[model samples]
Target: MDKLEEITSDGVAVCQPGLRLGQLESEARKKGWELRMYPSTLVKASVGGFLAGGSGGIGSVAHGGLRDFDTVRAFEVVTMEKKPRVVLHEGPAVHEILHAWGTNGILTRIWFALTPAVEWMQLTAAFSTYEEAFQFAESIATGNTWTKRLATVFEWPIPSFFTPIKRLVRADKSLVLIMIAASQADALHAAAIAAGGEVTFTGAFDGPRTQPLLSDYTWNHTTLWAMKADPAYTYLQCGFSLTECREQFRKLRERYGQEILFHIEFMKNGDGVVIPGAIPLVRFSTEERLNDMIAFCRSIGVFVANPHVNYLEDGGRFRPDNIQLLAKQRYDPRGLLNPGKMISFRKQVVTK
Candidate 1:
């Protein structure tokens, strides 16, 4: 276990990469501090893997993702050079290996930013239409009154898969799922009413009628539920600016309609405005059709972060990240760590 070294007067905590996010969060809670942000996979994800994968999850709506230069203050990574050296990378240098899929170096320790912990209420709301639910979620996310940790929207049938919450959810209504500070409970209820939706479930995770933590039903976990219901279904991760997202969602809903069940995680973009990170459940017909769907979205200006592929370049950015390649060349001279995950490195091997 990496020592839970100094937690400064401010809430920052420096920890070993092997530390589980949940474990660290638990420790932080004892000190009245908590991780400012973490993916929904907090239970199983490690600080190192979270940084390496450069993923965004539950808290992303408020604090943004790991790629933000400030998310990680520093890192100690071990290179794959013949003798193997532990090098410290700080500030901008951290970006070189971030989201590289661990193709370049082994992350050993990390300096994480922390904040005061808040007691959040797990809640849900239902709407007659997807647009209303999405609007309510956007309102809550953008509302100055509430500190939202999670704001998710799911179309009608998708909520049915959340079996534990089935009794709380109705069959045909679209849904809005949220985790917000307990202080803002009334505000969320009023917002839901103003948006013309019903506040359906409002309580804690282990209340009298307990249900799975609301975070479990957001992000890619939603895909897991759909997949379990039917193995043939696959999902996509796409990001669209707040302006374009609403329009794109309307078009897809009108075009594919029920064929593609709508789901979105609302978050603030770099500019601090609300944007939707969409993970619409697709009715898998064929691989070719999936590609066509992705292509069509790109043509319409939607940035699809393809999740079906294993290669780093073929994923989120859709091309070889030159920065990561350069870092690999500098730190992993032997190409010994996580080989073949970086397409550019593989090409370098072929050329040399």
Candidate 2:
């Protein structure tokens, strides 16, 4: 099942869901193409698992999210029935199974949209202040001066937890990690200098290298590193208004100080406008304090995708999509798939 069945000339990858995202990427890169978006856990996460559970990562800076980029051309789902049926969904219909946590149907095959491969260079920029680091990331994300696959910023002490590349980074400096086109290296260097930052590290990221990749220090992996460093750290998945993110960051820093380490991933929204998504590492003292902090984030227009809760509705940043529920009813009528994860299923059952 973990096979890369085909790579078409038009840049589409037809593969089994069991294929690891990293393996798919490597195979596609060999064919001069690459996945539109992938999670930071690409090496270990399967194609189906990412489609079912992950929102976005890596290439999202240029391509937007998995849902937004029209990245999924089709899905082949296996329904849970007395006689299970193989179903193929195309175009907009694929969303029925996307990010649903496998509560609707099991994915067997996926046709993913791919882009022409670029020789991406991994680089890290160090800044004297967190604001400078963020502004540097913002310039690359919003401007066309440099094409980037990833742009992630870490505030002060957060960089301290990235021990693998600790020698390349200053302990006191905030950091901006990027995976940009090798062609734009000079432009990126100049831009970093203009932003009051310096490119601390730069290397070629050509799939499965000996050295540590900057990507491993990004997205949810930032939280992973922090947690490894100190078990007291948990994380919050959040979104900030594109226009108001600077002020929001200010407010969050003021509120939590060093207690909540700021880690931001700059990416394009569904509308192709760049926005900031956060996976801030929180110093976990109690469940009450974490809940209170989440409430406070919501109060300030910072959208919190509450990861603390298990229910689908509670964890998602957006309202429950009716498409997902309708799919569940059609594919898993008995509510046998994934059991209690989908709160909407239980509600629909009660209403009957």
User: 273, model 2: CA deviation in Å?
Assistant: 0.4
Give a tens-digit lDDT track for model 2, residues 236-337.
999888888888877888988777888999888889888888899999999988998899899989988899888677887334557888888888888889
Error of 2 at 281 (Å): 1.1
Top TM-score prediction, candidate number: 2
**What lDDT does the true structure give each of the candidates?**
0.79, 0.87
Q: What is the lDDT of residue 176 in candidate 1?
A: 92
Clashing pairs in 2: none
* TM-score for candidate 2: 0.95
Q: Which residue pairs of candidate 1 clash?
A: none
